[model samples]
Target: MPPLPAIEQPAAVFVARPGTAGRLGQAVSWRQLMVWPRWVTLAGFAIVVGAVWAVVLGVIAGAVLGVFCIVVSTGTALIRRGLTARRIMRGSLTVATPGMGMASRFGSGALDIAQANGITRLFYDRVRGIHVDRDIVVLRYAQLFIGFPRELFPDWAIELIRAHRAASGTTGYSANIPALPPIPPIEQPDVSMVADPGTAVAMARESFRVTLRSVAILSAIFAVLCLFLGRLLSHDHGLAAGLGLAVITTVWLLASAVRGGPKTRAAYQLSMPPGEPLSARFGSEAFEVRTASARIRHPYAAMTSMRAHGPAMVVRSGGIHVYPRELFPENAITHAGMVNKLLAK
Candidate 1:
C-alpha cells in the first residue's frame, strides 16, 4: 500500500472574500423592488380616480384624468428610488445578497451557523448586520435585537467584508453591495431644562394632571349634549340644564379620581444603572414617576399621567389608561403623587 497522507488541522478558520458576479449572474436592479402588489395598488388607484371623475364630469374627461394620473405616478416611484439610492450610498442602508444556489453569484457560496447544537441556514437575500455602535442588530429584514452583546461571528465578519468592499471602489466582488449607513444616535433629553429630581418629577406629574383636566373639560361638552337631550324629552329647558350640570360633575369627579384615564397603553421595561425611577411617555411628552425608593421614566413623553389606584399603577395618556398598577413600586400614594405632578402641567 502507498504511504498514507498526513492530515493537519489549521490554526484558525477564516472566510475568504466573497466573489463577484460572473457573466451568467445578474444583480437585482432598483426596478425589482416594485412587485405585483404595487401594480395592483396602482390599478386600484386608477379605478378610484376614474370613478370620481366620471361622477363629477363625463367619461372622456374622466379617462383623460386617469391617464394623466398614471403617467405622473412613475415620477413618484423615481423620486423614492433616488432617495433610496442616496441613502444607500451614504451607508444608511445595508443590503446582503445571499448565496442563491443556482441563482447565486458563484456555484458554491452557501454557509451555515450553529448555536447550542441547533443550526440555521442563512439565505443570500437575508441581511444580518449590526448598527453603527454594533450594539443593536437588525436581522431578516425588520426584526430588531438589542440588549444582547454583539455576536462574535456575523457582525465582525460582515464588517470585514464591508471594509473590503468599500476599499475596492466599484470593482470588488461585493461592489454592487453598498455598506449600510451607520445607525443614527437616539436623542437624549435636555437636562438643562430640568433643574433637579424635583423638577423632573414635577414636570412629569404636571403633564399628567393637565391631561386629566383636559379630559374633564372635554367630558363637559358631553354634558351639554345630554342637556340638549333632556330638553328634547321634556321641553323644559331648566331640567335639561340641571341634568347637563349633573353629568358634567359626575364626569369631572371620575376624571379627577383616575387622573383623566383610561389613558393609552404603554409597556414598561428597565435598563441599567439599577434603581433608577420608572419613566413613561405619551406621544412627544415625557414624565418620570418617582417614589421614596425608585423612579420611573417615560423617555418618549407618551404618558400624560400615572397614579396608584389600589393595587395597580394607573397610567393615563391623553385620556387612555395604560399598564397594570402592580407593575410599579409598592408604595401607591407616593407613585400617585408623582403621577399627579406629571399631569399637572
Candidate 2:
C-alpha cells in the first residue's frame, strides 16, 4: 500500500492580548447591527416615538418631537461607542492551534470564559462566513461572532485557518479568489493631520449613514416579505397586515432621515484634542492618509466614492476619509477638482 500524506496542523498558536486602543467592540457592534431583526427593532422604536408625539401634540409638534428623538438616539450611540471600547479593552483573548480554536474572557473571567477553563474552541466548521476589512477580521457563526485584530495573527496562520475552513466545506465571504498584492505606501503629503476624537466621530457618522441606508433597504424588503407571508395565510387578514407593515415602514424611513441628520451634526461637535487635519498625498496609482496614529494607503480602485461636500471632500472606501476645506484654504477648490477628476476616471 502507498504511504498516505500526513495531515497538516496549524503553523502557530499563542495567547493574544487585546490592544488597549483596539476598537474590537465597534467591530462587533457593526456586525450585530447588520442583522435584519436589529434594524426592525430600531425602526420600530422610531415609529412608536413618532406615533406618540403625533397623538399627544399636533402634527407640527410631532415632527419636532421626532427630531428630538433622533438627537437623543445619536447621543446615545456616541456614548455606546465609548462604553464598548472600554469593555473590549478590559477583556482578554487567546488563540491556539492543534486543539483549541479562539477563546476570549471578559471582566475578571480571566482565561476561562466559557467555563471550559475559559476557552472556547471555534471550529472552522462552525464559522458561517468570514469578512476582512482593513485591520479587523470577523468570523461569523450563526447569531454569534468573533472579531479580532488581524495584526494578532500572522499571514500564514490566517491561511491555515482558512484551509481548515475550506476543508470543512464552510463558505467564506471571499473564497477561491486570488489575493491582491499588498498596497504600497505612498509618499508623504504636503499637509497632515492627527486623527482625534472628532475625526473618529466624523468617520463614524459616515459609516452610520451608509449602514442606515442599507438597513432601510433591508427593512423595505422585510416589509414586502411580511406582506407576502400575511397573504399566504389569509386573504382578508393579509391585506390588513400588509397595510400595517407599509405604515410601519413609512414611519421608520421618516424617523431614520430625521435621526441621521442630527447625528451627523452631533458627530462633528464631538470633543477631541485639537491637532493637524488628515494629510493626503495622491499618487498616480493610489493615495495615502497620514495621522499620528496610523498611515493608510489605498489604490484608486479601492475608493468607492469621492465627492466634494461644500468645503470638505469626502472619500469613502472601507471607511470614511474626510479632507476638510479649512485644511487647504488656499487650494480647497483646486484640490477638490483634482480629486473629482480622479474619481471620474
Candidate RMSDs in Å, in order, are 20.9, 17.5
Expressed as tens digits, the lDDT of each residue in 164-252 for candidate 2 is 56766423423543332212222445565564555555554554555567767866775675566446545655545445656666666
Q: What tens digits encode model 1's per-residue C-alpha lDDT throughout 29-146?
A: 1422344566676666657755655454456645654564466456656665565444332221111122311101110111233211111222223233323323222222112111
Candidate 1 total steric clashes: 54
Residue 264 Cα positional deviation in candidate 2, in Å, after optimal superposition: 10
Each candidate's TM vs. the true structure?
Answer: 0.26, 0.38
Candidate 2's C-alpha lDDT? 0.48
| Best-matching candidate per lDDT | 2
lDDT of 1 at 45: 63
